[model samples]
Target: MPQRPEELVELLPAANRFLGREAEVGDPTERRGLVLVHDLAGDFDAAHAGALAGAHLLAALPHEVIARFDADSLVDYRAHRPRMTFSGDRYESFTAPEILLYALEDDAGSPFLLLHGTEPDYAWERFVAAVARLVQQLGVTSVVALQAIPMPVPHTRPVTVTAHATRRQLIEPYPVYWGEMRIPGSVSALLELRMGEAGVDALGVAAHVPHYLAQATYPAASLTLVEHLERLTGLHLPTEALREAAEAHRTEVDEQIARSTENVAVVAALEQQYDAFTAAREGTDLLSGGEVPSAEEIGAEFERFLADQDRKKPRD
Candidate 1:
């Protein structure tokens, strides 16, 4: 386990200065829960959206603010290294904050922790293990993890959510869309495994958003995940703001699609592929190796599709 900085060691003592000493609005100790979120690649817009959605959920429910840790304050030592070259030896080092943590008092009076970070130099396994240990120490009852998945689907459609739980019994009411017998590179996957090993209940929800719009628009996926969080945690989130943002994103995409005939055609094709993929997954009880596409393959396909569209466009 990584050693905690002296600053984190004095959390309870620093609580008054950090979280304010005002009386909490609401306290619910019966059904305590915790939520963990991460923007794995540091997609700034996506992270902002996720943060907004999280804030909305927190505001709607009777929960107390516990502790918040900014990722910018957590230093990364792995990025700092001395380099040696044949021509000359030089020291090349860079330092940046690694992870952020937010502790919330849930309606059930349980502590919910939210985590986000920039892409780390080390493997996700190490990070997840450390977080699991922290959760164990905090005695968090249930953990909910959220993420956004960039997909070929159109932004005009409703965002779809896929969920995985450490224990099937914990998520009995919700639909079980997918599971990985072998874990993947996503931090959520590793953390789910660690949570199970530590006897902490954990669930993950991945919101699917149109890949084309992910860079320029992200609030749609954020709102979608927020809705799911409300359902899972029994918390109400004010979606008016997010809904407006999503509608604006839709209008922008509509204008772009109308202006370009090639883009319109490409979108039509993507819609078909999206529908087919969803149907295939829905019809299958189990996932096979052939059903999943590697991240590199997906990226390549997106590039090829965009290139072909560019080639078909009228030259200036």
Candidate 2:
């Protein structure tokens, strides 16, 4: 039987035994920032972005594992069945999810903490409590959450980022979301909310992904997240890898659009709507009076167009 969340939280300190081959160095005391990159809610673009950032951060910075959370308590193993890699005819090994805490340093020797792991299936409160305590113990000045959301935007346009923070000061001078939205909750969302109530500074960066490409590995979205992090935290994180990946992915997507006139038309229509909406933001609230094309309407049109194209394809 899987352990309960609270019970799992109790085992965090000793969870290092499950990290497989990854060596865990003890925590460093100089950490100043905390970045939360929990992969839940099944948003692939956000996951991709987090992965890219994590890779660069780990490669360029000095880091050590400070804490490990119990996967038995956090993950729903039945849903995410552990995979067995085939070494030979009958040899195999189990691969399990792990939650790890790392103390990292940037170019200027500034300290930061990265909490990278799978989002738990239960015990949200317990998880938040553990993270909050870690934040306080590490003297973390700010907590930043990274995510990507499917938006009614176009790929041809600049990616838009929706910013929010527990304290207005943290996200000021950036585009803030005031519209009432009811998104499915994520671990990072709850963590930020709990931390805010406890007076810890918390900020959220949501990269706006095109509805069509939300399920794909969108490196452009990843780059946007990294840029926002650098702007907010002065991390000096490298972006060359993400940049190259983005260009390649863009070319691939462009090729797909070129295959069908319907696809090209769909993209053009989305671009038009996006440009108008963005221009309206500078003057009046175009979204309030329903004067513009509804995001749902635009998305439906895009979907219908793609479906029609699929239906016309000759099956082998």
Candidate 3:
């Protein structure tokens, strides 16, 4: 027998309360409609920036779990095994993986939804359909995904991002850097694609983490993600804690890099590239000379670029 989409999730009574209370009092136009923010696919995130952002919001805001997904049916235990504490010969405790939906209140007392935790390992289509059903039932109007990717950028420079949306107008202010390319996919990416096909407003940002710090905890990237989330969703989110952590981490990283002349030289080279690009922001290309490559030149270079991007490589 095949599995049904409805079986994938269990909605709690609190979800109705979330809708019922809003329906009773708020003005129609004042409602921006609920925004569903997700940080799924743990391994896909560079430096776990998306997870950090979701965690920060949950920690800072008042929230409650409104729905739970069937993790056993979705997650592969071998890939992301749950932790077990064994004392002597007996097992004391086990930390199980879960996919949960949280209803939260931001600093301004506005309500929103967050889907956090493990991404599914199987039945992506069914999982996505289940979410779409929930979205309709919960009155969510837009979806925003939080992500981070390693880039050849410098920590000394301000963080930048690749902004994308289902509709171009949603992110008209952001620049488009790439033409067309096929890359590896994750469940979260698929969800965004399908949501757009269903005519829902979907947009997201992938903060550019310095490639050297891709495997490490980079609060700066997470902070940048939160800031973009605020601007995109019209939600007032607090970032003071993330800001403080980023500053402390920067000082620590700078001190470490200063100890190595080779590392310092590498960072200095990146800074030069970053500065050159900033000086010519109005220009189209990254080259400071302002020379646009021909179609043939771009194709050849892009082929070489594709060769360098092995998904299994140590650095992105």
**Candidate closest to the true structure, highest lDDT:** 3
* Stretches of candidate 2 exceeding 4 Å from the true structure: 1-47, 281-316
Full ranking by TM-score: 3, 2, 1
Worst 10 residues of 1 by lDDT: 284-293
Better of 1 and 3 by lDDT: 3
Give the root-mean-square deviation of each candidate in angstroms: 9.7, 7.6, 5.2
Better of 2 and 3 by TM-score: 3
What are the per-residue Cα lDDT tens digits for candidate 1 across 1-316? 5534333322333234323322231343432244554444333223344545665555544444334443433333433222333435754554445355555555555444555544444445555655665554444567777765555566555566656688877656545434433322545566777778877778767666566665444777778777777677674346777788778877877898889999888888766765666677675422110123455645554454345434644454
Residue-level lDDT of model 2, residues 100-193, one tens digit each, is 7776767777656777766676777888887776665545657887777666667776666767789888877674444554445667889889
- On lDDT, the stronger of 2 and 3 is 3
| Runs in model 3 lying further than 4 Å from the true structure | 19-32, 282-316
* Residue 235 in candidate 1, Cα distance off native in Å: 1.8
lDDT of every model, 2 decimals: 0.55, 0.65, 0.80
| Residue-level lDDT tens digits of model 3 in 1-316 | 6579889999998888756655564554444479999998455577788999999999999999999999999987776768999999899999989999999998899999999998898899999999998877777889999987666778887877778899999887777765776556778888889999999888898777777787788898889889888888889999999999999999999999999999999999888877776776755432112222234543444344334433433441
Model 1 has an lDDT value of 0.55
Per-prediction tally of clashes: 6, 1, 0
TM-score of 3: 0.86
